[model samples]
Target: MRIIQLFQVALVLMLLALSNEGRVNGERGDRQCEFNPSLSPRPHSVSILEFGAVGDGKTLNTIAFQNAIFYLKSFSDKGGAQLYVPPGTWLTESFNLTSHLTLFLEKGAVIIGSQ
Candidate 1:
């Protein structure tokens, strides 16, 4: 009798797990990930080049990135800002990211860490 009860409990747990196998958090069907570019549009936009960042992938752009964010910090009250990175490989050390600033990277643009 004890063996029969244990088997029944195991069967019930297995059925519960199988019922939710194809669902995510009780939601039916699969969901695709999506990114909407215009979800948070900034009123101000500035390019990294404006701050003297060379995208040759060799120049250490730590100062450039720092300066850019520092400059854009002023726009925090005016609907935020976007720091645009053009198509190239940018090398930089660690830098601080300010609030209300979006680091926009264009196609083919990449940022590499410097030693």
Candidate 2:
């Protein structure tokens, strides 16, 4: 009887797992500027700008970040490229927004603009 109960529980768990859905990064029920060249921004470049002075937020590699900004600015369209920062505490050191790009901050979002 115990063995049968355990088997039933395991079967239920398996079914639950099978029914669960999976989501991709920046591609769930989200709306934001996407990195598509056909779009306005034209995939000029990718930039990572942190918002907090000191925190565990992902840091944009100094040089690469600048280059990304420069690239984005240089070819900044009226509306095109997308800046995506996942949900969490993002400590930005500096943020330079370009034209035509939409900044998407997910829910439970914490964006600390440099004050």
Candidate 3:
């Protein structure tokens, strides 16, 4: 009985030591892989208003949209480009998207298709 109790205690202690070591190693690995925003290339953002997009829900902004996308395409080599539509109603026709372009719409922003 004495031998059995000692063996069980030894086994439990070994498991505890191994688990603690694994946890320490896991924490160290996580620290090594931590995210650093400055090390990564940041995408460029441009608001539709900068391209003369009038979001009054009445003005047709087809040309503005086209110009904005064309301008954003210029920055495709530097990470990517993001087109931001601010919070307002934007009336425009259909527009095409270029490669490496992201369209971000803020809350309460609406795009109405006009005939």
Candidate 4:
């Protein structure tokens, strides 16, 4: 009976130690993959408003987003570009995004999908 109890305690301790080891390794891995967008700034920046986007939550801005992306695609060879979304409720439909572009949203900015 004594041997059985000791064996059960040992098994529990082993499992706890293994779980702690995995948790510590996961924490370290996450730190390495962390990204801060503010740290890396885009070369060129343009606002969605420049493309005639009205962010009143009722306005459909799908074309504005599409046009903005199409215009920004030209700067891809220069150094990439950024599409800045100001604080407001922007209703838009699905649109294609280009490569080497950063879609930066300001604080309080919300994007609502319009199907």
Candidate 5:
């Protein structure tokens, strides 16, 4: 009787496994994978210096940073924007970020926060 019960359990497990496989295969057949270029954001780069940010390591650049971020927000629809920090010691305060904006820092670029 114990051997018969084990055989029945094994058969049920096999059926469940087969049913799951069939469901997964059917779903994959319904949808095909493809790449869409429009789905990706277009790349745009802007320098902090354009916004009057001085990286002298002493000047307060809070307003400069704010202006740069605001400018980038305007291009949020055109594939977003990228703020590039060149090789300099930028000193600024906290700032907010918009969607689809990328902050890129080059080598030797340092951002110092003012307390």
Candidate 6:
């Protein structure tokens, strides 16, 4: 009975250690593979805003979109801020992305525009 209990405990510990190590490895891989704004055409160090988003499927966040563009323009001179769009279907007339900007499109992202 003592040997069986010790073996069970050892098995659980081994499983926990392996699980932790695997989780760490997965995180490192994701971080390493993600897009970094530093490598964009121009790097920036500025702040942006996301305003007036409808947060629905029908309406496009015009003010929010424009705000993002304008904010990017503000930091264009200094260069190092990334404009991030949250995961959703964004309907906009147009979007002017800057060289220093980084656009991260998650899987199944949908951006609609009619011009």
Best by lDDT: 1
Whole-model lDDT values for every prediction: 0.92, 0.53, 0.85, 0.90, 0.82, 0.62
What's each prediction's TM-score?
Answer: 0.68, 0.38, 0.62, 0.67, 0.61, 0.49
Those runs of model 5 whose alpha carbons end farther than 4 Å from true positions after fitting are 1-42
Estimate the TM-score for candidate 5. 0.61
Q: Candidate 3 at 33: error in angstroms?
A: 30
Mark the regions of model 4 whose C-alpha exceeds 4 Å error after superposition.
1-38
lDDT of 1 by residue, 2-105 (tens): 99999999999999999998787689866544665565779999999999999998889999999999999999999999999999999999999989998999
lDDT of 4 by residue, 3-108 (tens): 9999999999999887777356556433443565455777999999999999899999999999999999999999899999999999999999999999988877
* Regions more than 4 Å wrong, model 1: 1-34
Residues 1-109 of candidate 2 have per-residue lDDT tens digits of 9999999999999987665545345345455546645534345334344422222456433343345455556555534555554566654546566666655555555
**Residue 43 lDDT in candidate 4:** 91
Candidate 6 ranges with C-alpha deviation above 4 Å: 1-49
lDDT for 50 (candidate 6): 47
Q: Which 10-residue window in model 2 sums to the lowest lDDT?
A: 46-55
- Give me the displacement of residue 52 in model 5, in angstroms: 0.7
lDDT of candidate 5 over 1-115, digit per residue (tens): 9999999999999998877773565563454336534534347768998988888899888898888889888888888988888988988888887888888777788999988
lDDT of 3 by residue, 65-97 (tens): 999999999998988888899999999999999
Total residue pair clashes for candidate 3: 0
Cα lDDT of candidate 5 equals 0.82
Score candidate 2 by lDDT: 0.53
Ranking by lDDT: 1, 4, 3, 5, 6, 2
TM-score of 4: 0.67
User: Relative to the unseen true structure, what is the C-alpha lDDT of residue 78 in candidate 2, on a scale of 0 to 100?
Assistant: 36
Lowest lDDT block of 10, candidate 4: 28-37
